[model samples]
Target: MIRPATPNDAPAAIQLLFLAMEDIARKISGTNDMQVVTHIFEHLFREPGNQYSFENTLLYDAGNGVAGMIVGYDGGKLHQLRKPVLDYIRWQTGAGVCPEDETQAGEFYLDSIAVAPGNQGKGIGGQLIDAAVARAAGEGMRKAGLLVSTDNPAAQRLYERMGFKVEYTMPFAGGRYHHLIKKIDNA
Candidate 1:
């Protein structure tokens, strides 16, 4: 069952996010230490309206615990909470990490999606993507977007199958990423 993430899901959600985006998290935190990353995530998860907040996450609970989660927000509003997030990271990690230019204006950005390694290949990722897109459309967004690392062709193909097309390519986290977008037909 997929549902909105609650504060109680913070630990699991953060773990899933770290698993999916550990490279980026490590880059941002300036340390590969997950304890530092978890500290940063814990701060952001409790703060409403920020990118990593629980308010912006949706979880897939597969009977036992959180099997997966998707985090997203409006592209235009993305910067509203940037300063605080960066400040928190800087304070904790001793240096601030540069934010990646991942989303475009006027789109609902699907920030991160991750399924437990043991639970993958079971269509949980696709369900999370579909649910995120539907939530974006329901919020009256015209498009939905996400970044797929160039190294991950399987993920890219999954996005392609879901009707997303490459809008552009950009350098991110010392690697190239394809920014994919899908038009959300709210009607």
Candidate 2:
């Protein structure tokens, strides 16, 4: 069962999100401190307008609890909610990290997707990707995009199989990432 994430899902969603983007999180926070990162994530995930807010997340539930999650947002509106989130991160981490140039304009940006460690290989990740794309199309977006680390060949392959083509390579989160985009067919 895939559903929109609720405030109550913050803990679970944060866990998976941190698991998936630990390196990126650390880069932004300027600390490898798990506690600080977790604190920042908790605040961000519970807040209303930020990129990682519950409003922008979806959870895959497999009976017991949240088994997976996908976080994304409209690229055009990406900066509208930036100040508050950045303020919160700075307050919590004492590091003012600027947003990376990750998504192209007018696209739906898939920020992060992760299944619980034990839940991988069960198709939850793919389902979440499909759901994210469908959500983008439903919102009238013309394309969907995401970044895959250059070293993460498995994920890059998955995106390729889903019809995403690498549009360019961008430096992000202390490493190079392939920015992939897929046209969203509304029909």
Candidate 2: tens digits of C-alpha lDDT, residues 23-42: 77887777889898888888
Candidate 1 to truth, TM? 0.96
* Tens-digit per-residue lDDT, 37-65, candidate 1: 88899778878878899999999999899
lDDT of each: 0.88, 0.88
- Segments of candidate 1 deviating more than 4 angstroms: none
Which pairs of residues have clashing backbones in candidate 1? none
Scored against the true structure, residue 9 in model 1 reaches a CA lDDT of 84
User: Could you tell me which 10 consecutive residues in candidate 2 have the lowest summed lDDT?
Assistant: 77-86
